[model samples]
Target: MTRFSANLGFLWQDRPLPDAIRAAKAAGFDAVECHWPYATAPGEVVAALAETGLPILGLNTRRGDIEAGENGLSALVGREDEARAAIDEALAYAAHVKAANVHVMAGFAQGQAAHRRFVAALRYACDQEAKRGISILIEPLNHYDAPGYFLATTDQAAEIIAEVGAPNLKLMFDCYHVQLMEGDLTHRLERLRPIIGHIQFAGVPDRGPPDAGEVSYAHVFKAIERLGYKAPLGAEYKPGGPTDDTLAWMAAYRP
Candidate 1:
């Protein structure tokens, strides 16, 4: 059965982290994925997951120095130490919370320097996480929403993943970003299925809930099923209205 992971980052912002976990379970989500869960106590998050019997599928590495305007550190030239430290911290937290994946944010970077740093960061994280049975994910944010983001296309991500050549390294395929960056979602989904560790979706352009989107997720979901993907599809979208009001799509998507 297909399952969905509520992205607490964009959903349930009105509440605390634990409360958001409970809200996701109540909303019929089988699992939850958060942007950065470090602010709340790990014990509290663990307790919530235990109570709800839902897995925390994944969380992200901290976006580096928000106050300094660094979206992330992993790909920044001359920040290898900071990037590795971030990876270590994220891996430790993921281990504590029993999370299966960690999305290593690439930040705003460009050219060869950034790419080299990104690969080095990933290699270090993959080696560190493999022993714990965890996977490392890299996502490509579309240029429209994230202008200077280091990664912006599936082909680019695939190339980097190939270069890294780590068993634990994989792509975080976001359908909305993919559609926005390059249309033909189904073909890309099928073509890139091997290297993809997790999949996410949202309404294109607006970044809203999945129900009203240029891409027909009905067919997309069918293609995912046909391709035999085993992981849950991450719902990482901003709610157009109340989060609850935006979930009519769940009734049909839930197992």
Candidate 2:
């Protein structure tokens, strides 16, 4: 079976952390992850994992620590200091939770200077974060949902990862975004499997629960299994109903 990670950010937006983890486990999931565990302490995350015996697959670094009103940090951003600071804080959070990966958001930083700044920052982030035994997973956001985002396609992300040539840096293969940009799911997965550091998804176009959309994840997983992908398949979708309503998807999703 393909191990699955519930994305708490989308499923339990109003519930406590423990409740979310417990819910995932109750629904027969083995792990859980989220975008940001806002206001939730790192100890709480560790304790939740302990209580439910479920691992947190990963989470994002504090996007500007919100209280500081800082925007998200990505490699393509123009602010070197901000991007570096974001990486440092993310390293600490990962250490606290003993996480092996962090989704490094490369938000919009355009123009010649912005492009140059992003390239340099990516190199610095990988070099600095490698000390913790954790790697930076770069994601290319879609043009529709995240307009002006710097890294908007896997091809571009793969190019940058190849250029930086860091052992700790790799591309995050988000199915929804990739489907929107490229649509060749299985073939792309086969080609990019080597550089892929993490994978996530939502129903394409709508970003809702998989069963409620046009993207047939059952076939997708079957194809992924054909390639022998044994890692967690991340459930990073917006719940169409209650979080538990998504439990039915697992019944038909075979690896």
Clashing pairs in 1: none
lDDT of each: 0.91, 0.78
For model 2, give the 10-residue run with minimal summed lDDT.
69-78
Name the lDDT of candidate 2: 0.78
TM-score of every prediction relative to native: 0.97, 0.92
List, residue by residue over 1-255, the lDDT tens digit for candidate 1.
778999999999999999999999999998999999999999999999999999998999999889877888999998888888889999999999999999999999999989999998899999999889899999999988889999999999999999999988999999999998999999998899899999999987788988785878888988998899977899999995689888989887654
Q: Candidate 2, residues 1-255: lDDT per residue as tens digits?
A: 777888888887668876888888888887888777646788888888888888776777556555744446654444667778777777788778777687777666666666567667778778877778877888888878877777888898888888888988888899999998878888899999889888888888999877766678888888888888787888888886788866677777843
Residue 223, candidate 2: Cα error in Å is: 1.4
